[model samples]
Target: MYLTFWGVRGSYPVPGAATVRYGGHTSCVELRSDRGKCLVIDAGTGLRGLGKKLAQEFRKPDGATYNLILSHVHWDHIQGLPFFEPAYIGDTKIVVHAPRAAAKELRQVIGGITRHEFFPVDLDAVPADFEFHEVVPGSAFEIDEFTVLPIGLNHPFGAVGYRVDADGSSMAYVSDTAPFDRMLHKQHFTAGIEEPSDEDREILKTMRANLVESLREVDTVIYDTHFTSEEYEQFPHWGHSTPEHALQICQEAGVRQLVLYHHAPAHDDDMMDRIAEKFGLLGKEANVVVCVAKEKMTLTMGEVTNPGIVA
Candidate 1:
């Protein structure tokens, strides 16, 4: 299996010199299997770049199948769907996997994106036949040779973190989530549930556990690590985590390899380098260091080709 990071920024789009090294585009990732089958996550501006690459790679692009797995419908996450050239190609097939009940409707999430007052042409003018798969928490499905599992996370607007298994290799993609703060919601809505829905709590706990579980004896774990201790201190409610939180989770879960993700747009190469220095120090102490993902970098998983510690 292969992993590619097209976009890493979070919350909103911030493109400038400060964010270029780690990248400024929002969440978009492309995964490929040995057989050349691909799965994409999020459709941020990076997808525009990725689409161009795909068009070149697959010369006979007609009759190609495209799968998009969405973390949430926040504009930064889906803003570039219209920009993805594949959507406009009449022969390509695209399937979008998105959350069901958390926040915005599917139409509201992707409607008129291409030609809103902001852009020029509408997606309706695009030529492809689009199919959407609306997935809620606890749902599981198969695409090509992989199994995809979605679990809910603690976000102001609900987001589904994913666990994917392919050819004995496992990777968990949880782009936007607060480490552990649903207690606030429990506190806020104390009057709503008749008796503190044990099932709901169990699900939340289970969702958190899944993060650790994916790391348990797994190959790769890509998690959202978009904040520093300082920023995290001020924005506790935002759905993001610190590198320390990521390291601790890796330690508890026993994940062999960790790739920090969902970088903040303001953290340029210098600041990101400092954060890596801190992470390396912690990893040296804890025996589990993680490397940040860069745009267009490829991570090969499975025993034969991948060597020790890809950093």
Candidate 2:
């Protein structure tokens, strides 16, 4: 299995000198099964660049086979769909697999950015060979060599995480959540600086438990670690988890390797590298690799077990 990151940004797209090291692309990831099945997740601005790359390397006389697994329709997660050239071209075939209950929500998300009010093109106007299907949570599906296990996540706008197993290699992608507790009890979120009512605390505990269950270890866990405990003070309830909290979750889940994903726009490459090292120190001799993802960084099932993975 080949897993490539196209974008790993949170909230919005940030492009400039400060964010250059992280490659300033919004959320999009591509996973290709050995059988040549293309699974694309999240269509953030980064998809535009990825589409350009695909045009250069994978354009065949026969159009590409692609499936889009959306986490949710948040602007930063779906805004780039309108700009992905492959989806606009007639030759490319795209199967959009998103939350069944919220397929309309997903469409609205992508549609908002492309509406004439915001951009020049209408989403419906795109001429790609396309289809959309709503997927059920906790359901497993197969395409070629990959089997995907879906789990609902705790986010105000609603989201789902994916655990994809391809030919015996597994990887999980879980992004965009305010530490589990906060999402369930929005009024008392730690970031919001409010004291939780007893009921709120109980609700938070329940939600946290559910989130933890959803992310319990598999193999490679790419998760939301966009902020440090210090930084969480500014955007407490905005729905991003801290590295310290993430470390705790990975440890509890007995995760083999952890990739700190969804970087803040404020952090630079060097800063993210430092953050990753800090996370490594917290792994307590476990195999922990907490690098922030970039536009072209590739991680696969084979790489995790290769050589020495110092915990």
Per-residue lDDT, model 2, residue 292, is 58
lDDT of 2 by residue, 1-311 (tens): 66788888887888888777667888899887665466888888888887886666556677776778888777888888877877667677777887743435645655667779888878777767667767666788986677887776656556778888876677888877667554352323353545557786776677567656656666677888878888887777677788777767767776776778888888887888788677777765555555557767877664443223211
- Please identify model 1 stretches exceeding 4 Å from their true place: 102-105, 182-206, 304-311
Winning model by lDDT: 1
**lDDT for each residue of candidate 1 in 1-311, tens digit (9 for 90 to 100):** 77788987786777778777778878888887766678998888788889887766654544687899998777778887887877776688778888864355675556646546967766666676677789766778998987898867666557877878886787778777777634323213332222326676775677678767655766677778988978887776666788888778778877766788888877887888888777877877877757887777778767423333233
RMSD for each of the candidates: 4.3, 4.2
Model 2: number of backbone collisions: 4
Pick out the ten consecutive residues of candidate 2 with the lowest summed lDDT: 302-311
Candidate 1, pairs of clashing residues: none
Error of 2 at 55 (Å): 2.9
Residue runs of model 2 more than 4 Å from their true location after superposition: 57-61, 100-105, 183-207, 284-287, 303-311
TM-score of each: 0.86, 0.85
